[model samples]
Every structure is written in structure tokens, then in C-alpha cells.
Target: MKHIFAALCLLAAPAAAQNAPHVVTDIAPIHALVTQLMEGVGEPSQIIPTGSSPHSYAMRPSEARALRDADLVVWVGPSLTHWLEEPLDTLSGDAARLTLMDDDRAVKLPMREATELGEEHDHGHDGHDHEGEVDPHGWLAPSNAVLWASVISKTLADVDPANAEIYEVNSKRFAEEVGALEQEITAKLAPYHDASFIVLHDAFHYFEATFGVEADAFIVAGDGSTPGPAQIKALRDHLAEDPATCAFTAPQENDSLLRTVIEGQGTRIAVLDPMGDGTTPYATLIRQFADDMVACFSQE
Candidate 1:
């Protein structure tokens, strides 16, 4: 009788494991969105850890295993996290995957032209060049995020039909919250729409376009690589010529280079994190980003 009982327990373990859906997301912001949708249903796992750039991140063994085990995987696609493409194809080929960048509902924006420094500025010497590509930082735009929420809820509902109602409810709440955030951010940043600023990278173009904020140019390339000397010289000349009031740096990047470039120019240096680190519930991240922009650009 004891042997039979042990056998029964062993047989039921896989069934128990299968009871809950396993969803995995690539980045923090996307994970936050999935978390909001999966509230009261199941927890989603984040593949890309905090403080890591998806542009150049290599997956760990554990993360690869998570991908293979996941029932559903959500990611921004190859444009952002190019490292995940082959792994997803080889390991989790059968698993359901949602590439947000390729989704028709997502509001895709083309990468803006690099600021023309001057006739002497030669872009060919600079290896950093993405003159014509789509920006993958769609989450920074609240409208794109709202669309993502709808798609996520539907995907979750399709996979875990038992929790369809909960996902739907959560998605509706998310949309309403995002709408409110958009209105609030618009009002808060309206005063700084005409203000010129420089970002550490070009990731904020979506955010800028959505909120009417303008960035004169970015200090670094889209891939987070250091700009070549020519690029740096061009940026310095542009700054000296135009004189932006604010220069923003990312949390992961050292601001010394930025300070060196704009020293004695009275440009206030500030930190702007594209990834939502240390903030949960997703909405707080969006709010914090807006607040940070206002704080930096609104400074006299």
C-alpha cells in the first residue's frame, strides 16, 4: 500500500506542474506589462535581468532553460534583443512566441536622422551609423504600450482560457491607467516641448514624439556603443553652436564624458533610465520617466 501511494504521488507531479501556465518575457518593462496582465492568474518570469542592456546581452544557461520550459514567450524581437533569436528558434521552437515589434498593432517609428553637425562632419569615419532603421523603444510610448497590453491579454487568454476573464479585466484597467498617465504626462511636459536636450542614447525618440518633447541629438549610438571621435567632435560642435540647457545620461553610463563635452556650457547633466529599474506595477515606471524628464528639462 505504501509503494502504491508513492507511485500515485509521483504520477501526479507533472500534472500539478502543468496546471499553471509559465510565461516568460525578455525585458523589465515587458515583464511588467505581462505581470499586470497575469495578475490573479500566474506570475511571469523576466529573462533579461536588471541593469543589463538588451542590445548586447548574452543569455545564461538558466534563462535558456526558462525559455525552453515556458508555455508562452514575449519579447521586443531581434531589433532590441538580437541574442534571443537563435535560442528561441532552436530551444523553444514549439512554444508560442509574441514578437511585439512585428505586431501590426504596435506603432512603429522610424529612426530619426542624425543631427547634421556641419559640412566638415563626416559620418563615414564614424562606425556608429543607423541612418534608416525603426526604433524598438516602443514601450516608452504609452499608446504603443496600451496596444501591447491588449495583445498580451488576448495572448494570455488564448493560452490560459480559464483565466481569460481576469486577464481581460486587468488589461482594461491597464489601458485606463495608461490613458490617464498620457494626459498627466502631456500636461507636465508641455512646458518643456520646445526645450532642447541631449540624451545618452536615441532610445527616447518614441517617448519624445509621443509627448511633444524634443531631443536635439543623442550622445551615443543606438547600440549603446561609444561614439567615434568624429561623432564626438560633431556633438561638441553642435552643443557649442546650439547650446542645449540639459544633457541626460543613462544610469549604466558614466557621465564624465558628457560633462567633459559640455563643460562650462551650463548644461545641467541628469540621469535617465530607459529600463524601468527598481520600479514595479509598470505604471510607476512610466510616471517616473516622465517626472525625470520634467525635472531635468524644466530646470533653469
Candidate 2:
């Protein structure tokens, strides 16, 4: 009885001494991805809360606290979630920062003119230099997501060595789900034989390219800056002549601005999200995006 009790105490001592290391991420997609990776282990506490724009997000006190307290920090690198780059590096010195873009194993997609592949509906080019650009919206690519999952799995193992097996198991299962999602999206979007959509922002270019859809126009010119009245008017006039069935924009977009410029146009405004806001499982997010696009086209 004494020997058994001593062994039980030794096992219990590790559990008692170990802290449940906190994990932090910039946006919902990474947050959800990490959550899926740590599903059976523990959910990661997100730095940027839901409905927040990661590109221009101002770090808050509580968010800083979360970052400082986290034992692990996973982000999509400075280019994508640019705002978080400096602050995270500064605040969370001890935390393990895993970047999908810097993973070395991630699959990269080439950048091209948004109008090049989409339907030939000229919305008047602003001559915005995309000369040697790479897509910033890399998470939209499923293959990249798989690479991220692997990075996350390895990082989780680094943070919580004892639970390495659990992390590996979760990563494999999640990778399989992402693979299935890619296949399903390809199949569902195969129809519409000839369909393309317009956007208020160029964020969806990667998504469009991946799913074989096209973005015809954007209210914003380049680098997420809004176009002037003349440019918007030109786009409106172009759409009037060749009305797009749908005009999709980000969830965090200004509806008043969208309506003001796009009013009297026959196009329907559909809110599309590249990030998995208010959703779980990366696969579900992809499905939601696919379903929304199909629904938009099916409406007409």
C-alpha cells in the first residue's frame, strides 16, 4: 500500500506542477485552426476577438495581457497580419511564435491581375502596381492550411511536450478534413459553367483563383484603399452596362459606402468572409464560403 501510494503521488505531482500553457492568435481563422489542433487538449484564447479587422486592428490592454501571458503565439506572419508582428515579438518573448508564411513548407500561389482571369467586364484599371506581388490572403488556400496545421502540431508539441501525441493525432485528423473540404468545394463550384463575381475589396483573389471563380471589380483600388468618386462611378457605369449578378464584400465593410456607390446597380451585395469569423473547424468555414457563393449565383 505504501509503494502504490508513493507512485500515485509521483504521477499527481507532474499534473499539479504543470500549468495549462495559454495560446494566442491574431485572427479567427488561425484561432479556429489552432483550436482544432488543440481540440481535445484545450482551446486557445484569441488575441483579436471576433468581428475585428486583423489588418488594421489596434492592440488593446487585455489583448496585450493575453499575448504576454500566452505560452504559444501562432500568426500568419507580418505581411498578412501586419499589425500584430512587432507587438507580439516585443511582448511575448518566451512564447513560441509559429508563422504559416515562414513555415518553409507552405505552398505559395502566384499573384496576378484580378481582372485578367475574371469575365471581361472592364471597371477601369487604376494602374495600381501589382507588378511583382504575392497574395497576402494565403490562408484561403487549403494546401497552405494543411502546412499551417503541421506547423501548429509541431509548435504545440514544443509547448506541451507531454501532449505531443494528442497534437499529432489532431493534426492528421484536421488535415484529412481540409483535404475533403478542398475536394468538395472543387466539385460544388464546378457548375455555374461560366460565373464570376465582383468585390469591394481585392481580398478574395486567392479564394477566387483557388475555386476557379473570378472577381471582376473592386470598390477599393489597391492595398485596401478606397477608390474616388470618379473610379467608383466608372465601375458603376460599367456594371450598369454589363450588370454583375452579385457584388460580394467583406463582413467588416461599410454598408453605407457600398450602397452609396453601388446604388441603382442591379448587383446584389453578398457579405463574404475569408476569415472564419463566428465559425469553427476550417472545413466548415470553407463550406460556408462556397455555399454563400453558390447561393448568390443561384438567386438570379
Candidate 3:
């Protein structure tokens, strides 16, 4: 009887594994983080194809089907991709949702204003009236990434209790890897205490704050205002005063205006890819950031 029961239990293992939840996620970073927890249990599918803007992505038929069939849907929340909110409610209504931005364990920071020459950033509000608005690039911070591992692990375990032990083990490994990666990057960037840079978008503040780096100035005001004559002149003047070693611009940006501003100022331009091409590992993305920033001063 014991031998017969052992054979039955062995046969049930693969059947149980086949019933794992079909988890779907948004963006590459979130997908990558969740991927770590699902190792040996199940793979998570990403809705956004990557290298695509989170703010504006037309869902493909496959992605739509994935959302519709998902057992769980994970995203950073509407702050980053408000467009996804409606789809989540209508299309993936039956799927369990995990919005990391609302998690209390994760650290949240307010949006910041473009700093002028000789102007100090207030860090919290920076004189901007953004009271309740929080920056959506929370994944850039390693600490938040660590918290997300646990959160994702717990959610997956809840949905697939049969794979709970696998999720727990993988999540712990993910946390340790991130902790070590942060320490190495922190020390690597420690020598850049006095270096400065320009950002096309105000997306890197979370990463900056985590590594003790700060942007010297920002071109766009984020209110949909174009860089006018006075704004251009202000940037020119700031460049003369606080010449940045590098200008960290986002992908798909037309940098001609920016190129004109720092033309003769000797600022090398670098691209900051927040969402990778759906293939970059989470650790690789973080390391690339530190490498780019360090290259800014090192190349000089």
C-alpha cells in the first residue's frame, strides 16, 4: 500500500505544477523582479513589449489575451501608466492585482521641479506645489526593489500555494543579490560626490537619491511647456556656471535643443533606458546606471 501511494504522489507533482497561476506584469523592470520569485514555479508574462514608453503603449492582441487570461496582474500603478488603469479594470477585472506603489513597505518620494543655476533643490517639494503627487520611478531605488521581491513572492505564494516554498526561497535570494549589488554600486559612485549632470526628464531622482547623486538642471518643466528663449538662455547660463559632465537623456528624445545648449560646453550625452528591451535582467539594468554615471566623470 505504501509503495502504491508513493507512485501516486510522484504522478501528482507535475499535475500540480501545471496548475500554477498565469501571472502577467507591466514594463520590463517589474517583470524582471517578479521573474526572480517565479523561478522553478512558473514564468510571468509581460504586457508591455519593452523599450516602449509605459505612458503610451498600444496593447497587442497577444498582450490583451494575456491580460484577459491572467490569474494575477502586477503593475507599478496608474502614476506611471495611467492609461493601463482603464484596461486593468475592464479587461483584467477578474485577475488579482498587485500595485507596488501602494505598498506601505516601499519608500515613496514626491516629484521635483527643475532647478535653476545657484538654486538649491528642496528635496521634498522643491518649491513645487506637488503635494500628493509621487514620482513613479520607484523601481530605480535598490531598497524598493528589495521590498518588491518579498511583496511579489507573498502574492505568488498566496495564488499558488503548492509553489509557496519555491517562491520564498527565490525571493530571499533576490533580496540578497540586490543588497550586494547596491553596496557595490554605492562604493563605485562614491567618488562622484561633486559631479553634476542634466536630465531630459525628471525620472532619475529616485536613483539619484539612492546613490547620493543629484541632477544639476532639467530642461523640460514637465508642464508641457517647450523650452522658450528665456528658458534656453537660463540653461545656457547655468551651463556656463555649472558645466555638467554629462546629460542623461531618455530614449526617443530629440536632443537637438539640448545639443545646442551644451554644444561648446563639453557635456557628453548618455541615454538612460528606464524600461529595457524586454530582455535586460534587473541586476544588469541597475549596474548599467552606475556604469553610465561613473563613465560621465571618468571619460572626462
What is candidate 2's local distance difference test score?
A: 0.74
RMSD of every candidate to native, in Å, equals: 4.3, 4.8, 5.5
Q: Write the residue-wise lDDT of candidate 3 on 1-300 in tens digits.
A: 999999898887765356779999998889888877887766789988766767678999899889999889989998888888988888889889999988888889876654432353322222345546788889999899889889888988888888888999998898888899999999998999778788776778788889898888776543223455666676777678778888887674667777877888988998877666555777888998789778767883
Model 1: clashing residue pairs?
A: none
TM-score list, all predictions: 0.89, 0.85, 0.86
lDDT of 1 by residue, 1-300 (tens): 999999998886654234658898999889988888887766788889988888888789998899889889999999888878999999888888999989887888876545442333346325645666678888888888889899989988888887788889999999999999899989998888788788767788888889898777776656556667777777778678778788888776777778877877788888877777523776788788888878887665
lDDT of each: 0.80, 0.74, 0.79
lDDT of 2 by residue, 177-203 (tens): 989888999998888636756777677
Query: What value does the lDDT take at residue 282 in candidate 1?
Result: 69
